[model samples]
Target: MADGILYGKPISYFPNGYPLFIALLKLIFSDALVPTILIIFNIIFQILSQYLFFKLLIKLNLNKELALITLFFVAIYPNQINYTRQILTEPISLFLLILSLLMYVSNKPFLSGITGFLAAQFRPTLIFLFPLILIHEIISKNTKKSFLLGLGVILCLFFFKILEYFNLILPPDNLKFNLIVATYSDSFNINWELARSKLSIIKNPLSVYINHLITNPLDFLEKRIISLWSLWGPFSVTHRGILEKILIGIRFPLFMFSIALFLLRKNLLSKNILIITYLPILVITFIHTMFFSQQRFTFVVEPFIIMHTVLYLYSFKGNFLNEN
Candidate 1:
């Protein structure tokens, strides 16, 4: 409300996905209604996303009963609903991601590609989902179709960048800034003093970052790994109070239990629905390992986490989770 919608340069520096959506609402309606409408729409979108996710679980051959259980957990999930009230990308990004996955599983590759492209615009890390989808297609022996879909998705992502290159859009170049900040800490807090001091001596931000990273690769890895931990689970988002605390308490153990089951079942090594479900988690993890890591930034992948957790506890049917 204060600075208005931000984009480009010294004043505001970020992608335009979430803000553009809000801006469109503001243009259509009144500014006063944007907040209330945004919150309401986000809640609705999240519910829809959950419904899609439940169907996805069923398609993956999870027991119908367990899929409903997973839907219940997702509907009531504290971390997810927490972002609905705020003017942030998490809600919409999550919605788009689930929609994309649903489209893909339903054999609508072109639509899935479009939805995934939108999700990545909201949260850049989600762009990694395309490669995972490509891998899934390869494994499913649909390489030609995956290639075309991926190409379309890539073109969508590069469209804006190409426009910017031609001086069409002026979104701020935040990559250098992100790299510079990464040298300090995994947290989003920018050490301006340190950054400014370093900038004073450096001619090129990218060069300095590359040199530092080359010299201290271990330190870079350590900070990113710790950041990923903070971003993934209960630590990432703020809890409301006692009720949320209880939910996290329940969720955490289930999460841990699921992880154990995932490994014991060798879900990653197997060529099945488990691998398809698991690959996105790895893709997002690797994306954060390289970019600015945060809870809200990676919220797009929460459904996958919740799905696997519930699946593990329920144990659908056969020895294999994937009926395909």
Candidate 2:
């Protein structure tokens, strides 16, 4: 797609923002060098994201040692590190999303909005977070900050519109296709061919989803239950290597353990900061339950899980020592 755009054949698909950015890079440097450059950028983004994650932990009042432990875990997580080898949106999107949350906690709402907008361009599911943040600010009675943040997002949207007007890029044109594929359970396979068959007959994808919910409520619930498992479970429907499978197996239990701890001990931590961190994670998880769910999709929010888990472990240790 980036090559097509460079050669004057821009195709409209789901969120071309990352490809468009890649095209810009290709225009600047030789094609051979672009891959190397992207790998370097991915590494840099990962490093910066870790730094911001640590900063966020401190801002939320976590002890330095515990925060460093969380940072180390995030830095070494297999899924997080493996993506740097490929030319994918995860690295940049993760960096920007973490930076946005840091800015929000630092009381820089405008900067938060700008980074959040950039993150959403790479991963459109993040767009749900902006309205949630806006509502959060309004409820907190920070009207001025809310307005500035909203203005920042609106300015970015205007810039996107200008790009669209000049044909520099195209709007997302694959929502119906995504929705159709999402309707099918991905427990065994994606079955896109079957989804396409359904899409051909269905005029409105939204109505199809709604009618499915209304007619076969039990089936709808079952599919969603499978999707939730697909999103977080250690097993995969597709084939994976033994080493990759082991990493996922380790990660899944840790994620669930951290979540259980957080639920039981949330009141003991900084509620506001933790809420800010968890809100997007919850939103994306819910959205995918309706659409499609995959481990890669869940990767965007795994850092928070790491943080929560590490925090809980340290707190537990401290309490144990005092008890002794």
Candidate 3:
């Protein structure tokens, strides 16, 4: 279905206007190898992305081995593998998203804007980060120039949203944001989130922020007790029973390592990219899981989650790290 719309003569399954840049190229070439070529280009992007991530990781004082391990995990993440073959937005979105973080960390605020704006093409939802990043700029005591560039980035997103609204050009769907999930959730526990929002307004806000930080998860566990352990393996879909799926859910836990690194290495501020990358995802998923769906909503965080999972593996020497 995705391939046909991308390669065949029709619209895509979802409103993936962002990928049309590649699609139009495929259309112009009119070759059966279009998808192959697209994937190949993404492969190049993957390599460059590794280098970029490594550069940032190194700058942040992480061990090189940790950086490599992180890159490895991101490379093989299963959901990414299953999705990249078609016109889906996940692959490119992952690339641009990470690039934005790398750019931000390297002190190249303008490039971050460009990369982040490009990311909006993959997932317009990133515009949500503007307020947060502005908070970062203010907290960091950035130069006025940096602050302006940050606003420029937000304006860039606004421009894209306008383009999408007019149908003049299709950036990703800014309007596609799930308001029900972002604002209110169906989950039984609202205590932490309610506290997080309130504390953002108070003096000495670190405690509440820390509490929110401690609980934020970037995992993709299926909500089934059975599937959680088997989540990434071939066995996930094999168990068809409702009760079994529920069992699988509990097994899926988030990458739960950022705080450990923050503490063990005393790297709380240096690892801001990791923090920035995961927090919005946590908030978004918390709402959606409560109000709309289940743990699979974790896919929103898949790209960064994979990156961290990759990094975490290097903590121990393993056979998995030796593969191509």
- What C-alpha lDDT values do all the predictions have? 0.67, 0.79, 0.51
Residue-wise C-alpha lDDT for candidate 1, range 1-324, written one tens digit per residue: 212542322123566566567766877878688788988888888888888888777777766776787788777766676777777778888888878777777777777787888887777667777777777688789976687678668777687667567543456445556667777756545476776576557667777667768999887777776666655554434434766545544545555655766776554324446555666677777766665565555456667777767656555444424445
Q: TM-scores across all candidates?
A: 0.80, 0.91, 0.59
- lDDT, ranked from best to worst: 2, 1, 3
Provide the lowest-lDDT 10-residue window in model 3. Answer: 218-227
Candidate 2 is scored at a TM of 0.91
Error of 1 at 117 (Å): 0.9
Question: Model 3 Cα RMSD, Å?
Answer: 10.9
Identify the leading candidate in terms of TM-score: 2
Which stretches in model 3 have alpha-carbon errors above 4 Å? 1-19, 31-33, 143-146, 158-167, 170-254, 258-274, 283-324
Report model 3's TM-score to 2 decimal places.
0.59
Better of 1 and 2 by TM-score: 2
The model with the greater TM-score, 1 or 3, is 1
Model 1 stretches with alpha carbons more than 4 Å out: 1-12, 135-141, 158-168, 188-204, 233-255, 267-272, 316-324
For all candidates, the clash counts are 0, 0, 25
The lDDT leader among the candidates is 2
State in Å the error of residue 271, model 2: 2.7
Q: Which ten residues in a row have the lowest lDDT in candidate 1?
A: 1-10
